[model samples]
Target: MKARITVMRTVGAAVMAGALAWGVVTGAQTDTPPQDASVEAVADAAPGYAVEDYNYPQADKILAEKNIVLKRGDGHIVLADCASETGLLEVWARSRDKICFKVTGNSGWLTLEIPSVYGVKGSADQTAQVDMTVGSEEKSFDVAKNSFAAVGESADEQGRDYMLVEIRTAK
Candidate 1:
């Protein structure tokens, strides 16, 4: 009876070992090329990384529609409707009657082009500095809060027309 029991235990162990060996052989026999190809395909389909250039959005559309050439900015300063708010910075140009911008945050900057700019109306909360140029000479003007300041030809001794190129403001 003991010999029969021992034989039965040995048979059970052998069967388990054979099953494990068969499983390993079967797993090894399966082709890995398809799996590698699927991984490569997934990698190729992945999207590229995003980057920010700080350029103004819809600039070309705005230029075509409103004739305003907005270039780059820190996003704190943005073009605004003149009638929308009272504290907006107002720019007076010969080419255009009036252009307005809203300033936010601790500081802001915008680069643009407005020919024949002569005056700027300051916002209530922020002090502003405008940069303008005529021919090869450049000039800067400081505008007080909530006040109108003469700039470009209005302030220039020679009364040369100046093109506004940049605006900077701080709270």
Candidate 2:
């Protein structure tokens, strides 16, 4: 019985290996079957395969802790600690103690939801526009480069709570 079990395990491994080999061959097939030298070229990673490389880093951890579902960005705008720096984009919130974003590059964009955001600071070279929503009403604000500006509820005399939805930057 032990010998039979060993044979079955070896057969299972061989079957798995063959299946993997077949999948690789079909996935890498171009107009022609991949030959020895052309195999490497034909097996270039698929476009769909490369997309996952750009996923938000540490996304699961961030989402679990912050309740922030940061989906995707251009890699130019990213979350920053409260005391990060002045020359980058800064977000001041009423409820949140520490909320900021570090924006690099001449042009960048990000989409997120931070409730009760009241103000923002923009970098000198990077003019920024932010989209916010208060209830069903949506508002946009233009923050001059290198300056601080009131946004969301801070701009309202009623002191309504507004959620910052998106951020765009351009040179």
Candidate 3:
């Protein structure tokens, strides 16, 4: 019985490995865009603010490789603005998601920016908190005074992993 169990485990691991391999190959294939298209064309299709101003060096490369355009701006990174501008705010995978923004517009009025997939985990008030896990580590951050907080392992630290952002409005 023990020998049989060992054989079953090995077979299961092999199947999982095969599926992961297939995902890496085929998943990557579908993301690539046309070779002849210009950078402008690629930028036009990206979500977020303006592609030129956002300074996510690593994300830029990833998006480019995937043929996705991301809108970025310099001064204020408002979640409402991004949502209003892009319309499709929940398009990224959990692992590669990060919220980057600069506070702008009204002093009291703020836009809470987070990956559309995760949604708003807490209230929109001044003091809000949420729990998120990236890989094996779990952490929590508070939203206060219109600040930006991201919950994801750094690319440098952890190859690639899920991240959550919690934006809280000031009271």
Report the CA-based lDDT of candidate 3 relative to the real structure: 0.42
21-139 in candidate 1: lDDT tens per residue? Answer: 99998886875676446445676687988888989989999999999999999998899999997999999999566999999998999999999999999898999999999999989
Q: Which stretches of candidate 3 lie over 4 Å from their true place?
A: 1-125, 154-160, 165-171
Reference-based lDDT, each prediction: 0.93, 0.82, 0.42
Q: Write the per-residue lDDT of candidate 3 for residues 1-171, one digit (tens) a residue.
A: 999999999999999999999999888777567798655667668777754644434555645564333333332324322334322112233544433333343322222222322322222324334334555765565544333333343322543454443333233
Model 1 bad stretches (over 4 Å): 1-48
- Window of ten residues with lowest summed lDDT in model 3: 107-116
Range of the 10 consecutive residues with the lowest summed lDDT in candidate 1: 31-40
Ranking by TM-score: 1, 2, 3
For 1-171, candidate 2 gives per-residue lDDT tens digits of 999999999999999999999999988667665465554555686555445444567767888997665656788888877576667678888756656678788788777788898888887578899999999999999999888899988898899999988899999
Better of 1 and 3 by TM-score: 1
